[model samples]
Target chain A: MRMPVVRTIIGVLSLVSVIVTVILGLFITPPDVVQGNLARLLYVHPPVAWVAYLAYGVTSLASGLYLWKPTRSMRWDQIAASSAEVGVVFTALTLVTGSIWGRPAWGVWWTWDARLTTTAILLVLYLGYLALRRVQVSREKRAKRSAIAALIAFIDVPIVHESVNWWRTLHQGATVASIGTNSKIHGIMAWTLLLGFIAFTLVYVWMVILRYEVTVTEDAIEALNISAWTLERENEIGSLSDEIAGLLSDNKDRTGTSSSKVR
Target chain B: MISESIAVAIKDLRVERRSKVGLNQVLPFSLVVVLLFGFSLNTQSRVLTTIAPGLFWVAITFSSLYLISRTMRLERENGALDGLFLLGISSVSIFIGKLLALLLTIFVLEVIQIAAVVILFSVHFESIALICISTILATVGIGTVGLIYGSLASDDRLGESLVPLLVLPILAPIIIAATNCWSDALGNHGGLGDPWLVLLTVFAIVFLTVGVSSFGAILED
Candidate 1:
């Protein structure tokens, strides 16, 4: 009851914020000096990238919690899976929006820039995580396997970024620099960017909650099926024993002189 | 711990000796891969020389994947993995031992690969120390992480196909760093080998620790 209400509220808030963000970003904010209207990607791309990283961070943390003793539970596993799933989607979005922006700005659909390369690798890593989750196995095995995969991938992230950076870096470094009085971007643009972050973060939170409910429901259905099957098996055994007892009694009555039901 | 690891490594090596699978099958397969690269991108093409390091490492990476999965599946096929657990050896020892055997086998395979590349692509190797150290560090990193994934995915049903998908992306650093380091050694580029070496060493240390610490959990039912 409470969960759905919270989900509803979050869903509504996310929808409204996203709508407002789009309106403001498209209409209210002015264009950049160099990038011109291309700067509009400033709002969409970074926030999506942030959400993607945010989602993966939650995944690794939740996975660690699941792997940790005393706090280990399927709940954490579910959260990790939910977050990874959402993270994968947002990661794809990051690449798409970034690519869309890059085509006009960078003059290519893609480049092997450090950030771009790392993000591409990240998308594949989590896609693998999701694939591992879908393999037919017991619930416990799938959770443990995918959780370990997530943490291992987490360890690779920084190394990948640094190695690629050393190899080459063509992408611009840190656009915001600062958000407030000392910001690189001055007026409504910065605020629109800020709004973008808020809106997408809200969207992430809402989606994860919904994904979590789906996983929980799937788990509950599995449990229900198992419980139902066990009950059915128990009933079959119970009726089989009753039939055996009845057969023994009928045999005794027919014989009338037999002891212990013809034994 | 060292003795236990050695014992486990010897045990796996003995199994490989009797089987001779890596020697007879995987080595030839990887060599053919190197050859395929040459055929696909003409040896007469100067670009092949430039990408020779990348090709060599790509073959090695595939070999790592194959050997890792095969070794783990060998354990599972015989029910020996669980039985070995009952012997009271540390999972870390098992991990190190398997990793050692993997590195030894891959080292042999890489020797052939290096020669193949040198002859086929006509590349030179001047910085012997850089080549040696980078190969060792990168192989160790690859072997450790590959073993972990192999163990995780070694179930009889879906593991074979799942390993490459899971391990490839995480291995991006090794691919990039090792290729760059070798590029320097092969004289394809200026010597910025130190930074790549640092990345490999750091990766090797970090992943070795991660594998050793988590092996028990990963192997648990």
Candidate 2:
């Protein structure tokens, strides 16, 4: 009951924010003298990259938590899955938009610059992580395994960002992040980017919560099925039912005892 | 405990010796890579000489992935890994022993590879000892992390393909550091400065510790 209300609020708010940002992104932001309309990608591209990093960062933190204590709490896995899903989506978008930017600016769709190649590799690594999660049979195992992958995946992020400085590559080095702002015109465009960041962040948090709710419901169904199976077995075997129940309960406790916190 | 580590490693070696499956597979694949490079490039000595070092290192990195996966998958499939788990040997010893064996295997293949490259491309080596040290240190780093990923992937079904994806990111530092050192040595530049070597050594040690410490957790099924 509470879920539907929360869902409704999040759905409406996220839609409104998306619409607002898109409008601002399309018309309000000024075009670059160098890139013209093509430069409009900046609003979408940077925010999406930022969001992707934020999502992976969330995965890394959640993974650490899960490792510290493995728990049935849907929250930790929810955080991990939500963040990874969003990260993959935005990473895909970043790659496409980056290619678009490349075609116009560099006159090539792809270049094997260390940055571009490393980013591509990073994307492949995460995709592999996601695939591993899908193929694993059990939820507990999936979380533990993917958590390890997430921690490992993070090794690439700093490297990807630093690839330009580390090696000679065709890709350009840090622009917005470079020391001292390159932009002289920091008015409406800057404001729009800030708004875009906020909008994406709100969407991320709302989506994470929504995904958590779904996972919780699924877990409950699984739990209920296990309980029903035990009850049915008990009825079939008269007096030994209690003993079986005790065994099942003990098994549950042992499995659940190790680590259970979601946050 | 040390003997236990040897036992595990020897078990792997004996299997490989009898089967020769890993050696056969990697040898042909590497040979194909060589042929592809030969046909693709012109027969200019200057060009071949320039590209030989990079080519050799790339081949090493790529082939190591396949070899490590073969070794790891054998343990995974036979449930031997679980059997070894029951042995109660320290994880560090297992890591070191495996690292040593992997280093030796890769070094042997690399020697054959370097010979081929030298004959084909006419490149020269000024200091074999320095190059050997750099190669060993680089292999140590690669093997340490490779052991971790190999162990993790052993738990999963994907096996060999999973390793490159899991590792390429982690391998970036070592690759960059080692390649730079190798190029410096080959180019008649001064000794790979102490600082860089120290960094490589430190990185290898840290990863070896991590691989050793985490093996138990990952093996817990």
Q: Which candidate gets the maximum TM-score versus the true structure?
A: 1
Off by over 4 Å in 2: A1-4, A70-74, A112-115, A159-164, A169-183, A210-263, B1-3, B42-45, B126-130, B156-161, B194-203
> Please, what are the lDDT tens digits per residue for candidate 1 over residues A1-263?
79889999999998999999899899999888888999888899999999999999999999999888788899999999999999999999999999999999889999999999999999999999998888878999888888889999998999989988887899988866566656468788888889899999999999999999999999999999999999999999999999999999998787886654667
Q: Taking the tens digit of each residue's C-alpha lDDT, what string does model 1 give over B1-221?
A: 89989999999999999999998999999999999998888666578888999999999999878898887888788788887788878888899999999999999999999999988888888788889899999999889889999988888668678999988998999999899899888884535347888899999999999999888888878
Question: Per-residue CA lDDT of candidate 2, range A76-190, in tens?
Answer: 7767877787778777877888999889899998887876766676677787777666654467766777777787667545644454335557766555563246564367777
* Error in Å for residue B147 of model 1: 0.5
Segments in model 1 whose C-alpha atoms lie over 4 Å from true places: A181-184, A237-263, B188-193
lDDT tens digits by residue: candidate 2, B161-194: 6778777767776776677666666776737563
lDDT of 1 at B66: 86
Residue A78 of model 2: what lDDT?
63
Worst 10 residues of 1 chain A by lDDT: A175-184
Q: In model 1, what lDDT does residue A207 have?
A: 96
Instruction: Give the Å shift of residue A214 in candidate 2.
Output: 4.8
Clashing pairs in 1: none
